[model samples]
Every structure is written in C-alpha cells, then in structure tokens.
Target: MQLLQKFKLGKSKKSPSKGHANYAYTTARVRAMKSKILPKETYPRLMNMSIDEITRFIGESEYKEDIDELARIHDGVDLIEHALNRNLAVTFTKLLSISEGDVNFLVGEKLKKYDIWNIKTLLRGKYCNASTEEILEAIVAAGRLSYSFLSSLAAKGTYEEVISELANTEYYPILKGYDGTNLSDIENQLDKMYYAGLFGTIRESKSKDRKLFAEFIRMGIDLKNLVTLFRLKKSGIADPEMMNLMIDGGLRLKHRDIEKMMPLSFADFVSELESNPYWDVMADVVRPDMVSLIDIETRLKKHRLKSAASFSHVYPISIVPIMDYMLSKQNEISNLRIIVRGKAANLDDDIIKEQLVI
Candidate 1:
C-alpha cells in the first residue's frame, strides 16, 4: 500500500505536465489491473462447471460487481456475456480516469479502435433489425466514445441513422463510401479504416511507450493477415481480390509477401510459415490435415500472447504490460467460453482440448 501511494504520488506530480509523469501513472494502474487477471488453472475449473456454477464462480472473483448487477436481468451465457462487457467497460474507463499525461493521450487513441468496433456492432444490429437492448448488450464499452453516445447509436434503429450519427466522428469519413451496403461490407470497411488509422497513429507518435503499443498492434495484424491468407488458400480462392482482405503493418509479412504467398499450395504455405520467425513456435503443428485453419489461428494467438508477455518485461514502465494483461484476460474469457460451449455440446475431452487456444 505504501508503494502504491508513492507511485500514485509520482503520477499525480506529473499529471499536470506533458512528459514522463503520465506514463508512470498509467503504468502503475495497469500493473494493479494485471495482478487481478485470472490464473491459468482457473479456466480448467470453469470448464467443468455448469453455466450457473460458472456465474457463481465469476461472482466470487474479480467480476463480482458486474455479475451481481446483471444477475437480475440475465442468466446463463447471456449473463456471462453482459458481465464481460460491463467489466471491460469498467476496467478501461478506470484506465482513462487514472492516466495523467501522454499516457492518457496514447491510451485514449488506442481505445478509439473500440469506437470502430461499436460502430460496426451498431451497423450489424441495424441491418439485422435487432432490438436496441440486444445491440446495447453486445457493445464492449472499452472505446473512446461515451456510454451515452454508444447507447444512443444502438437505440437509433436504422443503418442510415447510425451511419449519420457516426459521420461527425473520426470513423465517418472512412465508412462513408460503404453506406447502404451489406453489413459485411460495412464491417470490412470499418476494419480497414480502424487499422489504417492505427498504423497512422503509430507513425505519428514519438514516445517510446507509443512505439511499444504499435508493435503489439502490428503483431495482431500480422497474425490476422496470416490466418486470412491460410484460410483463403484452403478454400481454393487464389484470386488477387482475396488478398485485399489482408491488413497491413505486420512485423513478419509485407504486403508483397502476402500477395506472393497467396498463390502457393497448402504445403508450400505451411513451409513458408515454418521458415519464418514463427517457425520454431509453430513447427510442431505443421503436419498433414491435422493443421486446420482453426489450429493455426489458435497457434497464432498463443504466439501473440507469448510475444506480448516477453515484451511486457522488456519495458516495465510502458503500456505493453497493460496491453498484455488485457489480451490475456480476453483470452481467458474466450478459453472459458469455448470450454463451456464444448462441454455443453458433450464434446470429448481431446476434441475440446484441440479447440482451446491455451
């Protein structure tokens, strides 16, 4: 507690300044949050429990407030989903609140990506004609947009109205061309725009902290592009048009390499990946039909988690640890969701293990 007070004092001293003080505060808060992430063994236990048991388990854990509040209105998977979103919102909003300087600015910018997510969610809900309550429940609430703004957009009820509401925000210009299209097209456009903005923001940021954030984002993009490339190849879609779906700024593969690799046979594609930086990490999974796209995706996520964990220690005072904790927490949630669903479906243990990313 004394150490935390000292750290908080250091942060407050720098809060009024534009320099290192903000980073200190953000890093301190992030470290505290990281300490609260579930242990690895928690998921295996969650997997064996029923949905009601799972809810009770989470209620006894860090998600207590959210679980308690949502329990009255929802149950089962719906309850878990709402609790997750609410907890995400509370956690991220706290980050914004505690950060003082450039750390605050950087986190705010990175979080704008969530705005893009919310917009896409709203658009999809509108297109599907889903209820406002359903759309509201689906939002993650970890973005730069206020809760009121997101709630308003979700309640608007029409694709055009949602698009028009977002027009005044940073995402409006990028999504303008895709207006009135299918929800998938809108989703794709939003993804492209969000990533493009992320890359641009990375380039503009001069702080070492900002650079670390960019590397994490790049790692994610690389994994996503690799997955897309492999999936398209497996589906027998070799056209150049398919490459358009791949995002840029990956540390491992360039646009040209992605384009070139698209034409390769599955064997060649696996060999190409095996020879890259991810080779040693992914080498064990490179055999015959056993290497399904889902397996590759799971491996990629593992690699990213490992990479993020390593990077966290490389610069302890930066945002990397916070980002790593966020990813790990989300992965824990995803792993639990998969296990619960798998158990509920009565899948065999080996089959369930095969599907888990952990």
Candidate 2:
C-alpha cells in the first residue's frame, strides 16, 4: 500500500506551487500495485486451467473481491469477463482517487478516453438491439465518465435515444454528421472522432510526462490506422476517401501515401513496411493475405509496451513509469484472458502459443 500511496496521480489543490511532490504519494502506491501484477510463471499455470478453474484461481489472487461480487450473477467466461471489467474499473478508480496534483489532473484527463469508448459501446449495443444487461457488461469502468451516466446510456432503448443522450457530451458534436446511418458508418465515425480527440489532447499537453503519454497514444493510433488501411486495401476498397477513415497522427505516412497504396497487393504493402522503420519488428507478420488482425494487434501492443518500458527507464521520475506500468498490466490481463480462453477451448499448445503475447 505504501507504494500504491506514493504513486497516486493527484495534486493537492491547496498547494498550487508544489510540482512533482503531488505525485509522490500516488507514485509509491502505483509501484506497489505494479509489484503485485502476475509473474511470468503464473501464466503457465493459468494456461492449463479451465475457465472455472481460472475464475477460482483469480478469486484467490488480487481479483478476489471482484470475483466474489460477480460470481452470483455470472459463471464461466461471462463471469471471468465481468470480473475482469469490474477489477479494471476498481483499480483505475483507485488510481484516480489516490492522485492529487497535476499528475492527477493529467491522468484524469487521459481517462476520459474511456468515456469515449463507453459512448461507442453504447451506440454499437443500441444498433445491435442488445439487451440492457448485455450492454452493461461491455462498459469498462476505467474511464472518467460516471457509472450512472454510462448506465443511463446503456439503458436507452433506441439508437436515436442513445445519440440524443450523448449529444450533451463532448462526442455528440463530432457524431452529429453520422446521424441516420448504418452501424458501420456510425462505428467508423466513432473511431475517427475518438482518435481525433486523442490527438487533440496530445497536442495540448506541455509537460514531459504528457509528451510521453501523447507519444504512447499516438503510436497506438498509428498502428490501428496501419491495420485498417491494410484491411481496406485487401477488401478492394480503392477509394481514397474510404482509406481516409484510417488516417491517424504520429505516423510518417501521408495521405498521398495511403492513397497510392490503396490498389497495391498485400505483398506490396509488406514490401512498403519492410522499407519503413517498423520493418524489423513487423517483418515476421508481413505477408500476402495476412488477415490475422489479432496477431497484428498483439504485435503492435508488444511494440508499444517495449517502447514505453524503455522510455520509462529514461524518464523515471516522470509519468512514463506509471503509464508503462498501466500498459504492462493491461497486457498481462489480456494475455491471461487469452490463456484462459485457449485452455477452455482446448486448443493445442502450438496454436495457443501462436496466439499468446509472451
């Protein structure tokens, strides 16, 4: 708890002049939680367990409270998934609570991205006509939006009503143009708007910590854009406007480059990548007909994690370390979830191995 207390991201309103001291307490706490993240050996054991066994095992771990709370309402993969979301929400909220200074402010600001995610989830759920409970299950509590607000949005019975509710929020204005469209168009609008907001925030941050944070997010956006571009090209979408949906900042690729590459084959795309800075890390994943979106995403995540970890070492006193820990923890959680699912599906070890991030 000492480490957790020290690593808080909040700043005291009473002491406006104190700089990094605001993060002292929160940073310490974050460090302690970082220490508690699953060890490398834990995954091997988890990989051998069924979903139920994995749930029970997590009940004995840091997720004990969430598992206990969710077990009555869910079982199997549903239970595990809900418990994971609950734990994530609780952990991120705890992080928010412990923060006090500028660090707190910045973290809170970043967490708003989760609000954007929640809105997208609500819109998608509404379009699909999912039940209220099903929609509620998708809400990740890791963002700045209140649970009450999210619950209200999730409970909305129609897409129109959901959009009306969101109209009061920041994303409403951005989504206005997409009203009365198919779900795909709405989803694309959400994606573009979210990244646009993220880049806007990055542009405004002035601190070293903020710069690192911006870069981390930008890298993720760039990877996503790259993947989307590749996918659309494979689908034979030659129109540049269609490709523009995948545009994101932080990449050296220009609009012209994306347009010119629209008609190229996947092999040509791989060749283009081979000539770029990302070549070394993405070389193995490059190929014609490479449609493994999950694998490409996993590779991108690993690259981001490695970059964040390296940056943290270089800027230990800044927010980089805390952000690094957050990203690492997320990867750990995702990896464990994959392992659990693989075991439950009874996939062969080699196949599972191919899916794993570690």
Q: Candidate 1, 184: how far from true, in Å? A: 3.0
Using lDDT as the measure, which candidate wins?
A: 1
lDDT of each: 0.77, 0.72
lDDT of 2 at 18: 27
**TM-score between candidate 2 and the true structure:** 0.84
* Model 1 worst lDDT run, 10 consecutive residues: 12-21
**By TM-score, who's the top model here?**
1
lDDT of 1: 0.77
Give the TM-score of each candidate: 0.89, 0.84
Kindly report which residue stretches of model 1 are placed more than 4 angstroms away from their true locations once superposed: 1-21
Per-residue C-alpha lDDT of model 2 across residues 7-61, encoded as one tens digit per residue? 6644432322224345666767887888898877887777677777888899999
